[model samples]
Each structure stands twice: as structure tokens, then as C-alpha cells.
Target: MTVMTTHLESETAEIKRRRDPFLIILWLVLVVFALLWVAPIVLIAFTALKSNAEIMATNAFTPPETVAWSNFSGAWERGNFATTFQNSVIITVIKVPLGLMFSAMAAYALARIKLRFGKLLLLFFLFGAMIPFQVMLAPIFTLVNGFGLIDTYPGVILPYLAFGVPYQVFILHGFFKAVPKELSEAALIDGASHLTVFRRIFLPISLPVLAALLILDFVSTWNEFAMALVLLQDRNMWTLPLGLMSFQGQFSTDYGQLNAAIAMTVFPAVVVYMIFQRYFVSGLTSGAVKG
Candidate 1:
């Protein structure tokens, strides 16, 4: 017993020695990475507070004489953010939930439930992720025009759903495969339908992948510029990304207001990630472990 105690003590000391430096190194790396990420946001925050003259005359890196708190308001009004923001919200609100439900359900059906063409359909969707949206622009434009969705919210929302579904389904299908068959089998044994099992078992277990995919979809749809620019011709139908173009002039542009507009645009995506970040890592890992 005395020999065992001494051996255990030595083992504990050795572990401490190994762990301390590794932890220090990890923390240092994290701090450096965090600084790199925060630097741009800090620059944007400071730049957004400066006057246009200040941004032009002085180096962009220079701090402003006074923080122009009104820059946000100026950009908001000049950019007509109210209208564009409403359009984005309308698209996001209507798009994200529907996209999530459809994709998750499709993934569950493909991964869990039996289907004849499951592999072929999944391959088709996975193939879409490789296809650039730009490549399909002309055809998609013609289709939207034929459907009379031009310059309308449905125009953008529909395309967003189309693009979002394939990728999200790909993610969710993998996660659903990771879920223990026992859970679904047990539920079915108790007379639960596929829909009931999906809601209770798969949905709860799949939260992480859901959160991560939701964030990805939200950010992509929020920042979508090319499709919005093409589909939406009316100023009233413009989303924030399209409306940011309003700040440009023939020869000169308001750098301060542009930066302010950008900061506003970035804020929501950041907030969304922050809210769902806790689930992101777990979701990614859980899918892998289960599989």
C-alpha cells in the first residue's frame, strides 16, 4: 500500500508537469487567435465612429478625435436600412424555420426511414454543394421571371430555401445516422409514427447540428448579394446587402458611412453565432461520435 501510494504520487506529479505547459500553450494560442479576430471588429467599431473627413484625411488606423455616435443613424437613414432590413427579416423569418424543418425532415427520412432512391437523392444534393450559385444564375433568373417572382420577397426567399436545403440536409442526414437506432426502434415499438419519433428522439439529439446549420444558413442568406441584386430591382425590395450600394458615388464614397453600414450588417450574424456557439462544437462532435 505504501509503495502504491508513492507510485500514485509520482504519477500525479508527472501529469501536472505535462498538463501545465500544454494548458499554457493552448491559452497563448487562443489569445493570439482571439486578438487576430477581434482586431478587425475593433477597427470597424472605431472607423464607424469617425467623420467622413476624418476617415479620408487621416489614416484609417488613427483613432477619431471624437466618436461620431451619429454615424450609425446617418448610415441607417442614408442607406434606407429600415426598408432593406424589413425585407431581410421577412426573408429570414419566413425562410430559416421552413428551411430547417424541411431539411431536417428530409434528412431524417433519408438517414433513418427507408426510401428507394435515398442514396441517389443524397448524391444529388451533395452534388449541389459543389455547384457554384453563379453558374446557375442565368437559368435561375429565367425561372424566377417565368414564375413572376421578380422584384419580390418570394424571389429571394425561394432561392435561399433551394440552396439552403441541400447543404442543411447533407449535414442533418449525417447527424441523424449518428442517432442510436434503439431510440427510434423503441419509439416505434410504443406506437410512435415516424413524425412522432422525429420530433421526440431525433430532434432533441440533433440540436447541435441544427444550431450550427441554422447559423450557416442565416449568415449565407443575410449576406447574399448577387441573387438579391439580380432578383430585386425595386429599391423597396432591396435587402441590406443591396442597399449598401447606395453609399457609393461616381467619383467618391463615404468610407465612414460604408464602414458603419458594414458594422450594422455584421452585428446580427455575430450575435447569432454567439447565441448558438455553445451547441456548435457539441453538435459537430456528437454526429461524428455517433456514426
Candidate 2:
């Protein structure tokens, strides 16, 4: 009877410990931070739905008196979003896959092959990634101009591909290295070529990382502004970021419409992240502590 009573008391104490006050406090702090983080997005959403007059009259946190659905239509038409959005899609479509293909091939070589100066080669690639894109802008523009490719998709795409490759290679290299050696070896022993092994074995296991990179690279390519601005002079060729800038300028006085344009600009990336966020999180952590 004493033992049973003691066990009951011990369980009660454990339950109390589990519900520690510090843990509750920590959760409350986290909740506050989460609200803080989401506040700007909430504000933007509210502002997008409001009219210019209402926005001016009320505080930023106030709900709109009436939702202005026309703001989106106005933004779309005035912003030339149809043309700019198409351009961005074309650039991202062409750039991301080519970049990933090249990066994957380079990473596969680095991971599976025993090349002389392999580490040096990797450092060289990493070094390129470390260099600021701003630093390369002048040279990139000059090169594109020399090619007579200004305002062309190729002009914008080439730079994006070049800038995208190094970081992608670094990520893929880590992922490829983490994959089991035995799988590749077994495939090789079955008379598979290096290309076959890479295509059949490595690529299959690397889907999470690839999906993560797909969304990330898509966002980067989609949001790229400086290089696109430098390379593309034609308004028709302007990507969404540039078009958004034009939209903002055109509707500078109209906060509702401007915010609507801002919302439209961010929507695609947000959707992409929402769709692939599971893979993104897993891919980032997969190679961090290789078992």
C-alpha cells in the first residue's frame, strides 16, 4: 500500500514537472514572436483590401471598411503583369533546370570520382558562390552587351545560370556525398556506367534536395532584379520585379492598389514555398548529420 501511494505521488510530481512554468513562459514568448513575424503580412493583406481614402483615414492595423477587389484588376492592368509575369516564368523555366543539370553533373563528378585537385576545384566553385553578385554586375553587362544579347531572354538567363550554379553545386555535392556508397558501387558492378548510376541511383534518392532547390532557385530567379534591370531595357522584356517597380511608380499615390500589386508579386513565391516547404525543410537537414 505504501509503495503504491509513493508511486502515485511520484507520477504526480512528474506531471507537474512536465507542466513546468518556464516551459509555458517559453511558449508564450514564441507565440509573441510568431505574431510579430506575421504582423507585417497581415498589415499588407489588410492594406491591399482597402481604398486609398480609408487607408489614409485609419491606422495601418485597422480593417478595411470595404474590400476593394478592383485594386487587383487595376494593378494587373497598370502593372502589365501579364507580359512581365510571362517573361519571369520563361526566364525561370529556362534557367533553373539548366542550372540544376549542370550543378548536378558537376556535383556527381566531385562526389563519386577521384579526380586530381578535386578539393581545389570544389573550393573554386565555393569561392565563386562567395563573390557578391553586385561585384559581377559590370562584367556581366559588358559580356552580354558584347554578345549583342541585351533585352533578350538569353542575356538575362545566361547570367542567372552562371550565378545559380555554384551554390547549387555546393548543396548537391553534400547531398550526393551523403548517399550510400554501396548503392552506387552495386549499380556499377551491375555494368552500369557512371551516368547510369547517377541517373538511376543518385538522382532518385536526391528528390527532396532537388525539390527544395527547385523552389529556392525558382524564387531567386523569379525575384532577380539588378541583373535583369541591367540586361533588359525593353519594357516588354521586364520581369515581374521591374514591372512591380513600374506598378508602384504608376500607382504611387494609391496605397491600396500598390499593396495589391505587392501582394500579387509575392503570391507566386509564397505558393511555391507552401507547396514544397516539407521537402525544403527535410532537404536542408538531411545532409547536416549524416548517419
User: Largest TM-score belongs to which candidate?
Assistant: 2
lDDT of 1 by residue, 82-152 (tens): 99998988998899989999999999999987779989989998787777897788888899999999998
Q: What are the per-model numbers of colliding residue pairs?
A: 0, 0
Which segments of model 1 are wrong by more than 4 Å? 1-37, 53-59, 249-252, 288-291
What residue pairs clash in candidate 2, if any at all?
Answer: none
- Per-model TM-score, in order, reads 0.85, 0.91
Query: Best-fitting candidate, measured by lDDT?
Result: 2
* Model 1 alpha-carbon miss at residue 275, Å: 1.1
